[model samples]
Target: MNILTELAQIGNRLDPKGAISFPIYHSSTFAHPGFGESTGFDYSRTNNPTRQVLEDAIARLEEGTKGFAFSSGMGAITTILTLFSHGDHIIVTEDLYGGTYRILEEVFNRFGLQVSFADTSNLEAIEKEILPHTKAIFTETPTNPMMKIADLHGIARLCQKHGLLDIVDNTFLTPYLQKPLLCGADIVVHSGTKYLGGHNDIISGLVVVKGEKLATRFGRLQNSLGATLGPQDSWLMIRGLKTLALRMKAQEENALQIAQWLLNHPKVTEVYYPGLKNHPSHATQLNQAKGFGAMLSFRVKDSSLIPRILKSLEIISYAESLGGVESLITYPATQTHADIPLEVRARLGIDDCLLRLSVGIEAAEDLIRDLESALR
Candidate 1:
């Protein structure tokens, strides 16, 4: 069956009645049959029927051994980081999501977890940064705001050779477009708040593991930390995921059109979309994923045009979050990557003139016209 059909059919087998939609279990704790006999769920933190269905669905979609859902993307990331010891180190993509960068620099660093930023796109740069304590390599391909792609297979091979864990954040291009685990990653993480959730209605995170041992370890941490997704939110994510295939297809098509239009515009200085042949990572992306995702970043000819563009937009919203049904334009320097120090942002090419667009499932021409009007 097609992935679209598989997603829409999730939880149907478990539905007690003939109801098409999966029912949400609102109970926090399940009643035991008798003393010392539990119903497979003792507490909400440990497990919930509704949440389990969503988790299993994601695991199946990502082709991983198991899946774990969290209250938010940062919660999932933080819990995963707990797998390492205090002195352990990790090598990460230089142009990562700002939230991930902030947690590593502000929270994890204070707890003695060390991290090294490297341009993972360059295999040699990753090799040079490995320390004796380096335990894992974390990367976000088609990285946030900048849309820089990392070679997943190459990174996976590097991890295997060095006995390092290969962790990938698949938020920007969800499993529909790219399955990182199949490309040899040990684990794949998602900000379900983005593409997976499809709508801006709920905030959730997911972690899928490639083996039973890693699944067990993460399961323990997920319960202990208690950042698990609530039953209602889990149901919401499941509902959102049901239409992922349709949304992603339409969004990517719209993005490609907008990207091509931006390239020819007088006010646009540069367009960064992996679908473009001129993109530095185009070949690598083509090798690893089914499609270049809907996220694109472009720089305007002048910084002064940004404020006017943001104000002039009618259909597209000037927003912080992305991957929703409605298109969003983000100013990375002030909104997304602001937490990064000015020096680091400059080094990563996240300049004041750059704008990031998260294309929606809108008519391609309408989105292009919106951009044209804003640019004018």
Candidate 2:
């Protein structure tokens, strides 16, 4: 049977139990009848039917051969990056999510893995930085905070030519909006804490591999390294995925209206949203993503104005994390991107006044009004 059919069957089976809404396989271990012989599951970490179902759904949605669910987004990334050895090198976008930048610059460096942050938007710059030790190219298109758009197809082509793995963080634009695997990426990673979970209550990560070989490799690491998502969290993500398309549609609209509003505001110095016609990546984002995505950023006319604007918000919460039923506003320089050095953040245009918003499925008019009142 097809994956969709399987998902429907699972839903149908659980519907009668009334447990489908939130099925809890709270056990840490599964009982096995005999040595090396099982009732299909030997351990919770190695396998869980609920987690499997979610993984299957993600794999199908991303059009990947298989999927691995992890404890967190960083967990998924670490698993993939761990595949390379000490001397191996990785090239990543300079404007990546700050957590990702921290991991590459801090943890990976200590492990003897050489990494270089490059402007993936510029092919020539990426080429200039590539070394013989380079084994992978990592990127996030419509990148975190900055909304910088990288040419996924172009990078994938380069990876193919060099026989290097291309890993794209598809968190900002979920499978519903943009499937990087279809664009030739070898691995598609997600901070399922974002749109995939939609509710923000669950912390989960997913990795969808392009083919059976890569899938097997990731599976081995996932099982051996043991960062698999809990059964309960997996169920949460699965349920959330059902409403992703719907939520994203509303979020895209909300984000577009809000971005336009910010652009016209006198106190707003600049808006960084691919939906805007003047945005550098507007055309490219349009070509790849279904919508401009729910994430947007803007800088205030003065750095001192930020505290007032943040305090003035009635609807959007000043917080870390994003992608939920409720909107969130984050000061990236102090919150999400704090780990990156001040010099590096400034180079990437993430100034102190920059505010990143993750629009929710709330009424666009209400959200716009909230922003208007805040900026006033």
Candidate 3:
């Protein structure tokens, strides 16, 4: 069956009731069939029917053996970090999400996980940073706000040679656009709250592991951490996954149109989008992924235009989150990447003038007009 068909019928086959929509099994506990026998669900925290459908769907979509759902993207990330132990070293993407950086520096560092931030886009650079204790390389291709693209295939090669785990954050480009596991990734993570959930209605995170053993370890951590997604949110995520194929196509087309327009605008200094022909990672992205995705970032000619652009937009929202039905614009310096030190942000090119845009399913012409109106 086609993946789109699989995506649309996510919970239908799982539901014994033959429900067109996946039913939300809201009960926290299930009655055992009899003493010494189980109905497959003992408690909601450990597992729920509704969340199971979502978890299974994500696992299949990413071509992995196991998947876990979490309360938020950070929750998913935190759980993955816990896989490491005291004195375990990990190499992370340099232009990373601020929240990930915070937990690595403030939370995990204090607990004894040694981490080194490096430019994962450059395979040689990552190789040089590897220590004897290094256990994994966590990467974000088309990294948050900066739009740096990593070579998933190259990273996988290095990981294979060094006996390290290869993990990729696929939030920007969902499974519809890219499947990191197919490219040899050991694990794939996503802020399902973004593209997977489609709307800004719920917070959810998903992790898909390549093998059963690794997946079981994550499953144990998920239940132990107790940050798992609720039955309600899991159902919401199921509803969103149904329309993923359509939403992703629309978002990508709109993003490409907007990125092309930004290149010619006098006020726009530079545009960071893999869809653009001139983008540094265009060929690399083409080789590893099916599409370029909906996110793009551009810098204004002057920092003064920042406030004007943010406040002037009417159709596009001035907000922090991305990969939604509604268009959103964000300021990295003050919004998404603020936790990182100013010196580091400057080096990564996440300047005060840089504005990241999460293109939506809105008509391309209308979105362009909105940008034109705001840039004026």
Candidate 4:
């Protein structure tokens, strides 16, 4: 069977009634079979049948040894950072998501953990920033907003040479388009709220570990931190995942059309989508992943046109989040990457004129007309 077929078949074994839809185990705790024995789940935080199903599915899809589901994407990121000690340092992609940057600079920095931002697209830049205390390389391929691609296999090899953990945020491309673990990452993380959730209905995060030791460590941290996803949300994630392969295919198709249209538009100054032949990392992306994914960013010729364009959009939504079933646009300078210092944002080219688009499962022609109307 195909992976799409396999995804849709998740949780069938758990449906004792043959209802097709998996039942949500809503109980907070499982009953014990005996005084000294338990039914595998003692508490929801430690383990829940519904959450476990979603976790297992993600692990299988990513080809990892184990999986973890968290309350939110940030929760998963925070928990993963706990694996490092106070003095341990990390090298991260300079153009990664704003939330990740905020967490590292605002939350973790006070705890004594250090971070160095480097252009991970440039292998030499990454090599130069590795400190003696550097414990890991955290990066986002086809990075948030900017759509900057990183050389996953190369970075993984470099990490191995220095004994550093290779951590990748696979939220943008997702496992359907790219599997980082298969390309040599040690751990893969996702904001299930976006693509994996598919509907913008639930906020969740996922972690998949490449080995048993890392799985065991993450499991312990998840249980101890009590940031696990609830039964209902877990069920939602499972449902959303069932149609992910279909959703991604449609969304990527829409994205490519929009990107090409934008490249020739009079108001557009630049287009950043890895699918484009002229993209800086187009060859590397083609070599590492199955597709360019449905995320793209472009810069308008004038910053003054932004307000009018945002207001004129009919089919597309001016929103903060991405990877849903509806086309959404975001102003990264104010909305997503605002947490970064102005100088840093400028350096990374996430300026006032840049707009990020998360294409949906809409007809490509309709989306193009919507953009045309907005630009007019």
Q: Against the correct fold, how does model 4 do in TM-score?
A: 0.99
- Candidate 3 lDDT, 175-271, residue by residue in tens: 9989999999999999999999999999999999998789888899999999999999999999999999999999999999999999999999899
- lDDT for 125 (candidate 4): 93
Candidate 2 global TM-score: 0.94
lDDT of 2 by residue, 1-376 (tens): 6433443443345534666454667777777787777787778898887888888788888888998999999999999888999899989989888889888888988999998999888878888888888999998888888888888888988999888999999898887778888889999999999888999798888999988887888899999989999988888887888778778878988898988888889898899988899988778777776777899999898998899889999998998898887899999999999999999999999988899999998898998899889888
Please give the CA lDDT of all the candidate structures.
0.93, 0.86, 0.94, 0.93
lDDT of 4 by residue, 192-289 (tens): 99999999888999999998888998899999998899999999999999999999999998899899999999999999999999998999999999
Candidate 4's C-alpha runs over 4 A off are none
Give the TM-score comparing model 3 with the true structure, all chains together. 0.99
Off by over 4 Å in 3: none
lDDT of 3 at 96: 87
Worst 10 residues of 3 by lDDT: 13-22
Off by over 4 Å in 1: none
Clashing pairs in 4: none
* Residue 105's lDDT in candidate 1: 97
Screening candidate 3 with a backbone cut-off below 3 angstroms (N, C-alpha, C), the clashing residue pairs are none
